[model samples]
Target: MTLAFTCKKCDTRNIYKISRVAYYQGIVICTCSGCQSRHLIADNKGLLDFPEFGRNIEDYMESQGESVQRLVLSNTGVSTQDSSTRLSPDDSGNES
Candidate 1:
């Protein structure tokens, strides 16, 4: 099976090949193809590790007329929009 996730550093989507090794390892560590940043894959709590991953898979399967099981990942209704709008440390606090 293939697992997908977004790179936190570069904001790039990545796909990892899940294999027997992952099961044996308990926790799989993956490096981002885009930014080369490392990330952990947990044996459990995959939904938390990759919140949008399952949803992406669901969309693809539906497009192909395949039935897929839904996984509820997120519990917190926290908004990402506010975080995205925050100014970087280097910002001069000016909006243009």
Candidate 2:
């Protein structure tokens, strides 16, 4: 099955099949490292929950060294910016 992961912060979200761990799994970080306001304000216990479909960020954070945090944060920022730009204004409100 395909799985999706989204950051509680910035917005970098991605999808991968169950077996894609080596290359495509959603790596989670537990040190409250997400780059979004949501993540910054979120409790550690709940950070992984709102993203809904991600692997346990803490597992990867705990196991991996600190080398990848920058990369992850970059991706998250891109995702958040891209998502905000693509949002569709509710048609119920008005179409412009």
All-Cα superposition RMSD per candidate: 15.5, 14.6
- After the best TM-score superposition of candidate 1, give how far the Cα of residue 92 lies from its true spot, in angstroms: 47
Per-residue CA lDDT of candidate 2, range 15-72, in tens?
Answer: 4444334224443222323553222211234434455433443334445542222111
**TM-score, structure 1 vs. true:** 0.40
Off by over 4 Å in 1: 20-25, 43-96
- Scored by TM-score, the top model is 1
> Distance from true position, residue 46, model 1, in Å?
15
**Candidate 2 backbone collisions, by pair:** 10-36, 28-57
Give the top-scoring candidate (lDDT). 1
36 Cα displacement, candidate 1 (Å): 0.7
Instruction: Work out the TM-score per prediction.
Output: 0.40, 0.21
